[model samples]
Target: MQKINKINQYLLENYPSIWNTRLVWMLLLGIAIHIIFFFIGFVSHGSPSTLQHTRAIDDYFSTGLVFVHIIISVLLIVGWLIFMFKNNAFKNFYPGSRNKLFLEFLQYFIIVFVSTTFYFSYMTGFRLFINYKYDDETMAKNVDIINRSVPFLSQNIEDYTLENRLSPKPFVDFYCETDINKIDKTKKYFVYHDRVYQYFRLYPKTVKQTDERGQFIYPEEEKKNKTALAYFENNNDDKSRTYYFKQQVEDLSQYIKTAAPSYYNYSAVFYDNANNPSTDIRKYRYENDINNLNNKEIYKQKQIVINRETIRILEKKSSKELEKLMEDFLAVSRDFDIANNLNARDWSAMVYHPDTFEVRSFIKLYQTKPNEIYDPNKAPEGRYGDYTKTVVVDSAAVSSDNYLNENGEIMQDTISARDFNPNLDREVSPKDYFKNNISGFYYYTSDLETFLGNVDTIKTDDFFWDAVHLYIWIAFALSVFIFSFRVTDLRSLLFSVISAGVIILAVTLFCVAVAFTFGFKGTFFILYTILVVGLLILLMPFITAGRFPKVVSSVFMIISMMAFPLFIWLIFGIVNEHQVAGCRSQVYVSDTYLNCRGVLDDFGLKISYAMIMFTFVFLYLYTGFIRKWKALPE
Candidate 1:
């Protein structure tokens, strides 16, 4: 208790202004208030899991909370200022030099400003915490779901073969004319040539021999054969109809050789013998003259051959079943392509590849025919289950003839290959295929978008530092304005403030007028001249011993204290401009020249250091001069 009393006595003697002003208590109160505000900011909004709740929270924090904070700060500052005026301890009892007085004012100003504005630090910390937590959770969930849902292609022979088979390749010609008539006229079907030939070989006797009047003797068989024939003849005119048939025929023939080698061998021999008339006649003569064999045995052998071919064609249809199996394997390929191209950094999280099968399929199945997927007015189901609640496609997604460049410049081009034929030129990897397209497909809930939008790239530490630096400058300016009341009478302080405002306004208008009339160089010249004249006036107290000169010098000292940093900045700008002009005139300009040789690198830090150094120097000079001016007789 004795030690505490001694320390209090020491503070009373050494720093009476700090002791009597109740600065410590005022600062403690400010800290307590800030702590309360921080808790309010951190916990006011409940954990929101839906878009509606998130939006409401965002509105309250961004607008309503900020407004309330500002009002409270204003009230606190006003009450504190009134309390400081009532005490007036520094003005009454302190016998400190002007420099010491100014330092004291700085201390009070910083405490008040921090007490009022420290909530920003807490709020910033809270935002950063929420953003980090949400981003980590969302990224983890998205990556897991995407990996599970998408099938990645690997470098393997089996996969390569599958890719080729599914991909659109050049057509091969083969005989498919036999089954051409089997195709339905009402529906569209891809034609293969080998299937046509198989139909003719299977039902060779189905062709009708019409009478002179073209009357139907065998109407049913004739009609069927005629339909097949007509389809074959009509489609044969298409030059590109030469695909898939050759592979089909070879596969079928190989199957036949393996499955029924005896039938294949016998059919080959029988066709060869029947084609030669001498062999046919010799067989008939031998049957009639010696064996007396009925034709039933020969007819039965021929039926066996026909039955084998019929079973093979009907069951396998030349690997048509295999194609269906491949389609099933690649069912998620389109959806994977769309999801794989998503860019989380982008606000829309969409990266479109118009040439991709996924994009083409979407354009065809959704955009072109909205009814096929869902009503246009209603939200469509997300491609990847519940990860998204809405899907939006921009109009640019449908445009085929124009695309944006790196600089966002639009260039014209021919219609993309995907638009011409989506099946053609299929890429092995969806990433490789999506590089050229600019269209977008957005699929995310509004809540998710809000979370993503709030995920700023700025580090929390950097934000806090910036806020501190900005508020310190504000505190310094406020301190200087308030300190003016201590140094002079109310009338003199008011006159000085009004005069300063008027001079600043006039100078700004004149610089603007000069810049508009002449150029930036004219404005620069005017500012440089004003800085020189101010410096000259500041030196007047040392040059001449007169009340008028000392008063003028004192006023200029105050102006110079503030304007010195700006003067340094202007000089740096002039030097950089001169260097840039020189670099531009050179014929072989390097990257250094392009970047202006980094003349203004770390400019802010340099300027800040300069300001700090000059501030003390100006205070010493101003206070010393003021002492002498006060000593002189009025």
Candidate 2:
């Protein structure tokens, strides 16, 4: 004990400034701890430079790992700085010793500036490299995966082309009324089926092709349209006859549905009477039978088929084989519909019930339903109205301030029209707005512009507010430094700034971890809720301490430092989540989300909290230092 006392006395006399035994020991301990943890981190998790190659998504595990790494590194740096200051390592070389406060400020400012620049540069560079890694082999693998995933992706175009190519021609012969002849051939009308040939084929060619008076004749012949054949082959005939009929019904339903849906129902045309028939001809067998029987008249012709090959194809084909063929055709049709941007509901209907997709019925529905094929971007004039023009076309005719309606009248106070810029909207054409303004490919140019704009706006706004916030932090630090050190020296100010920053960062990190870990769950949620409410409790005593003003002020300062970031987090966390969700959903490209997600995730709760805390400390110290500004003698 006597020896220790002697040593302390000697130290106090010989090294009055840097001879505090307790601080010296603490400095050694701090150094040891920092080294140990840093080494462990390097061994367990590869260096930050190496970890740059790791892929991360907007999820907890990856983000948490990164956060822990950054937080630990910051803590170590701050701890070492604190140890150096406490041990008076810079006492002789300190900037304030030469009374050069500008040099001190300039040095710290460069440190902050360089650190911020390097961090952002490193992160953005890594992100760019990762995004561009999709080379030819990777692209080929992706294509193959997509093809395998969706069976129809490869066959849509092929099937659509084949169906269209084989579709039967429209009816070339139709029976109609004429002033000159009782029965006249009309080329304009279409008979849904090939009944003309069906009826004629039954009679041998040796029989007179034309009956007396040059009038074509068929008394008893089977009517055969694709629809009738389809029905008879499935319901009315034996397997042998069914197969023969099945070959006749070519899978032209897709084509006929589009070509002439209203007229393509039945194939045969029947006169009211077989002889001395009236001008009226009926396409339905039931209607012809009823009309002829009611009027006691027989029609001139019963049924006919023109195409022989239509029936020959199914001659020996089994029902199962026909079913398989139909399945293949349906698959292609369905695929084509999707490829051509067909309505999902319509395509589903065609696939589910091909039999219901009759000519007349489909035509009526198709004509009445809205056409989904049209593109607003490439619409002809007078099609999509002026709204499409603002979104799709680039023109000064409708400036941001003055939006012209179709009638040439200015639309007053229209928010969308007033703020409409091609840069913000994803639909803007490459040739119009993107090519000149953006550097990257045309596809992502508009989205990149919007995302970058969002980032710029956020950063500028943050800086504007942060400038004031920074003043508060620096002012508080300055007050604390002067009080603690009993001196208004630049060295003290620097120590104070660094000390305050470490505390704020440490507290902010703890709060962020609490929030992130709890994820607003039951007990953790309650803890935060109490902390948020207790802010008022922490403030009330300071506000009401009228008798002991100095004590109250000191207590208030401490409480405010701890609670300020939490307050900001609660308010802005909610706001930022809303902002991110809105912006993310609106962006057409994913990179915007990728770029912004790290900053905005957890509602930017962590980032904003940390930023506010740091800014508050800087602003608090700086504000006080400025009022008592003085240039000490060199």
Candidate 3:
């Protein structure tokens, strides 16, 4: 108790204003209150959930708690203001110069403002906690899932297996055909042959064919045909002739029939024995058969028979290969399904939704029937009348039966039936239906865009800190305005406030009129003009030599409390605009051209600094002048 008294006595002797205002006690209490609010906010925070009712309850609790905290802060500040006003050290003739008085004012202002807005810091901390505890883990899990699934899903299976003898294209074609018609289309030899031919055509590989001398027939020599050369040179000149010639050449090659591995030897043998019919009877038979294969329909039937035989041989050889490819596809599909299910669950939890009851009430309010008893359980229906109408385009003429005069001549109707509406006669618009029926959760889904928005907001960046700092300055400005009454007499305060209000109203009206007459630039010019005029008024006391000017300047000083920082900001804006214009004019290749937001991005810090510097400088001079003016005789 003795030590406490000694400490209190020491504080009283050294810092009378601090002791009288009970500033320390109030600040400690404020800190305690903020800590309590932080815990409350942390405790009340809800995790993402699937149940709509649970989310709704959490939202209400969190929102209501914030509101209550804000109200309590307001009350606490009000009480602190009352307590501080009870003892006026400045009015009591306490030992203080201009600097001391300004410092005292600053101390009071900082304490009050900080106490009021410290909640912002606590909230930011809570967001940081959430980001660390939950969001990071979820993001890592999502990234892992994406990494595991995307590579396989993005691959083209056909490209991967193009070199394999038993390609997966046949199986895919078979699957698609079965899916569409509930039958294995591959069973048909023509279908299977067509698929195989298409697969080889799409993924063309070099095949070496030998001449009778056993020398390989190079593709370069085959492509040197004069007719093919002529077609290549002038293909665009005749589209139909080019297409016909291309198909004729392809048919002559019998590419599908000869390209099959099983029939390659047979084709070579047939080619070799084309002119040796007398040497071998079987060769003579084949030669006769080829010479007789002149009819197009007979050739097609022979091709079909060849395809049937080729398919039977290939199927027997590659059934196991086909099964392996199918298994691979199914494995990839299963992984994709797993990833998709995880994404859906995460998305459902991350999306924002309003309270279900609130949404229901809003719908009920807007969709109620005009003359019927309100029934919550009944579904709302739109009123209807003759609402459906169709417009006829490029009509020849109106029928005489529809529009005719009494003498039977056709007459135009001045008032069209389409223009007449005697009742509520429109179907409900799509927008209204969507608004009344759409769930908030479905409407605001957790897509990439919404996820990015949430991340941007919650991330602890310069933007978040800047916003918090800006609020603190705003609170400080309010404190200064409130404390201005403590520094001046009641009559002066009242006169200054009323005169400032009138001047503000007049200036606002004039600026609005200028904006209407010209545009935003004109309003901007008017505001700058007012800023210059106010600056001149602020400088008048220092430059001029009279009590009247000083007194008038002092009155204007109270009104200009908030304007000091605004003046600096406006000047900064002008300089930034000039810089942006200069950059735009230049042809420099740089990021400045792409992003020309400003000269400096830390606007909040700059403004806060301006507020502090201008407040100290202005208040220091003003306090001295007011003190001297009060001493002078009227």
Q: What TM-scores do the predictions have?
A: 0.50, 0.25, 0.48
Give lDDT tens digits, candidate 2, residues 365-396: 01112443322234333222111211222333
Distance from true location, Cα of 100 in model 3, Å:
1.6
Q: How close is each model in CA RMSD to the real structure?
A: 25.5, 29.1, 23.8
The per-residue C-alpha lDDT of model 1 at residue 144 equals 32
User: What's the lDDT for all of these models?
Assistant: 0.41, 0.33, 0.41
Tens digits of per-residue lDDT, candidate 1, 431-499, equal: 222223323333222223233223322222255554565566666666665555555435545545565
Error of 1 at 328 (Å): 25
lDDT of 3 at 616: 62
Count of backbone collisions in candidate 2? 44
- Model 1 ranges with Cα > 4 A deviation: 1-14, 49-61, 87-89, 92-94, 97-99, 124-446, 452-461, 505-524, 537-546, 549-554, 585-594, 597-617, 620-622, 626-634
Prediction 3 TM-score vs. true: 0.48
Question: What tens digits encode model 3's per-residue C-alpha lDDT throughout 1-634?
Answer: 9976786687789987767556677777877876776665454434432111212223323457657756776787788778767766545553347766666667677666656664564565556555664465664454333322221221111211111122222322211110111112233221211122222111122334445543333345334541111111112211111110111111112223332112111111101111110111212221243223333234333333333333343344443433343344334324222112222232222221212101111112113334654332333343121112111111112111244222235545343212222221343322242234422221111122123233334453443445665666766676676656666566666767787788778878878887788766543486477777677756754554254644465466566664666666667766666666676678344533655555445464665666567666766767786555545444
Clash number for each model: 14, 44, 0
Candidate 2 ranges with C-alpha deviation above 4 Å: 1-75, 86-126, 135-149, 152-552, 558-622, 625-634
Q: Output the worst ten-in-a-row residue range by lDDT, candidate 3.
A: 264-273
